[model samples]
Target: MTAPLIGDAVRAPYDLLAWLIGLWSDALAAVGDAFGIGMLDYVFMHHAFLVGGLIAVMAPLVGTFLVHRQMALIGDALAHTAFAGVAVGLFVNSLLGTGISPYVTAVVVAMLAALAIELISEITDAYNDVSMAIVLSTGFALGAVLISLNTGGLAVGINQYLFGNLATVSRENAALLVVLFLVVSIVVTVTYKQLLYVTFDETAARVAGLNVPWYNRLMTTLTAMVVVGAMQIMGVILVAAMLVVPVAAAAQVARGFREALLASVVLAEIAVIVGITLSYRYEATAGGTIVLVAVAVYVGMVLAGKLQSRRDVVEESGAVTGGMDATAGGSAED
Candidate 1:
């Protein structure tokens, strides 16, 4: 039987790396500590503030097409599949004593999963929902098995991925996240016209000679990057909320894709700020708190929509009554 990677002295480099990560995380936490806060407090406040803000900014930029194309569930699928990939990476690193990097493994595996989803959807005449169901169920099951095989305490790691431990993020991880966000931002903005054209009408886009396949793959790859990066902060279980909630909220009022993107970024930023504050006050998970904030925003928007509908009805009724009065006056004059 293979030994545990978590405590393996032979994997000295792994320990060194992990320790370095911990030190950086502490350093970041200490920045907030300067303000008289504890490590956890700092993470809960500043880390969430940073990660949530980044997600809010990017999600809307991509999520406009995702929502328009009815692929919000794709984010959920990728999140869960990435969880399995992380577990597998951990298990393999433990079993092989290779001091493998779980973060790198997660990105590779998740990218493969994204490709698989695309392939299955395109290749089979079968329903996309069925394909998603098969992939999601299998992915979760595999992840559970991998977790069980790990001699080290996989539960805590898994929990961290599922519910998020934003307070414990390392500087390297945060830096990596920032870099990924910048890359995604650049690609999306540079190819904005092509992406929007393809999003609204793929056939037309293709007929116009846009490289639909290449763009599709590029979009999925960008999504994979976002998912992998977010897994560290939001956990796999709730990360999808970041991608979905902002776009949904923006959709309620936004007219065009550009407007929706702007609205999503703004609402997402608000949700993150509100969520972080609430989580700090209630001693809750940062991921869960952020998700809750987004949900609350959506609910408020829905209520607003209902009220607007009622107002429109009243306005229409008054307009009809006024029109009838004008006709009656004209008849009396005749």
Candidate 2:
């Protein structure tokens, strides 16, 4: 078997993305030379930053909706399926002589798994955690079996997929991440209101003339894209954290849904930038480092939220007591 024709179809975009990456690299190299930033001096680090920044944006963009809709686990399910897809791609390449990118296969399998999640929910007349759990398990099991079947040389490379590595970031894969970012951002921007409506209330969205099921499918598909894109740096085990932690942190401080969305993006970007920098400084795993940073951010946000709530309560109590005292004083004067 050969690489899919879709590879040919996307070759032009890949070329364009490569060109953009070159420009970015040149810019980063100049800045690094000026500021003595060692990391920006390397091409792999450039690609790592590029891919990580894009993942930070899209993961939380879709994740806001997922967290609000209580579907955050869907990222995990799709990510596991994507892992299976990676195994499939590697298996094919090993058995045959194709040069297919595992990320490509991961995207396809993950999207299909996304649809399968919706289908399972529909057949059962509700969004079902049990079904999602089954999908997650099955996908992982499939990937494990496939990996065992090709254990001769595949195990050596599998760690990159399982734990992720910054050094493995390649130009072609970065370009693919760019494509996924554009698709996810554009779709979400175009249908922001519809998704917001559905996330809050499917029955209300349907009553207001929206195709709830169709939107559900769209959300899951976007999630699948985000999961695979982030998997490049975050890995299958940690990708879902990118989809939930930032959003949850934002929700702690945001007063409204839109605010939560914007805050999530800002927080995610912070986590990525800080995480990547720290990972480079200490030579830590990118995925684990990023997740740790994100969770730390979440804990900070939670503490801030609690403090704000306490302050509000104190203010309210003082205002009420003052009003009562003023009334009593006025009655005495009367």
Candidate 3:
């Protein structure tokens, strides 16, 4: 009887182990299959990566200066202003029923708005931040009113524009974003030195014949171009996170301007790539996830900075003690 009971107990455990193994195997296979499909769906899959990379690079390119100049809020305003353009585009497309590209129209209108804001600031001699605030509120209010009037067509697009939905990004939008990213990259590269000079010291750059106002306008235009491209990928709502957060994180770690720019780009790229991957798996909005990743990185960087500061203090104390000991030894020998 005892022998029979022990044999039955062993068989029961073996059966249970086999069942668990099969279940785990099936689960892993399902995940693998999904991953395989994602890999094969390159056309759709590549859209996020392409757009993400463009925004990642461009945001940091402009954002480093925006942070340095303490114009982070202006970046926020410009993003909202771009929303009005998107709304107007939706309205026009609905009324005319033509092949109107809302994003292209949005970019053009946003550029004009940026130009107008710059002109207003120059003429009124008002605070630029205040000027940006006025433009942001005005543009968003205009967009909100238009959206209310054309509730059906404009409303759907506006909601997505404000919060962003990367999974819904269309092919046309992706292609246009690619073109804009290339254009912005070339322009920034060509004017890099002038931008850096003006960003550091506008008065000195102006006296040295760097055309400060022109560079300022050029920078704004670049920001607009990036904003338009990013609007599709990250949407107007979270795109500014890419602009400011990565740079802020990078600033904590980097020493020189070039290093900061490179670090910011890397952080931005990491955020987008990882965020989108996780979002795709979890069925979340890619843009929001990307911004969240950026926030996490920023927080981690702050903590790292604090730790580094502590380490530096420890090292400095050790160096001072060693120097004093060496001086005492020399005096004793004398």
Candidate with top lDDT is 2
Model 2: CA > 4 A from native:
1-9, 316-334
- The TM-score obtained by model 2 is 0.92
State which candidate, 1 or 2, has the greater lDDT. 2
Overall local distance difference test of candidate 2: 0.90
Worst-scoring 10-residue span by lDDT in model 2: 325-334
TM-score of each: 0.79, 0.92, 0.82
Error of 2 at 129 (Å): 0.8
List candidate 3 segments past 4 Å from native.
1-42, 313-334
What local lDDT score does residue 77 receive in model 2, on the 0 to 100 scale?
92
Better by lDDT, candidate 3 or 1 = 3
Compare the candidates by TM-score and give the number of the best one: 2
lDDT (Cα, 0-100) at 145 in candidate 3:
85
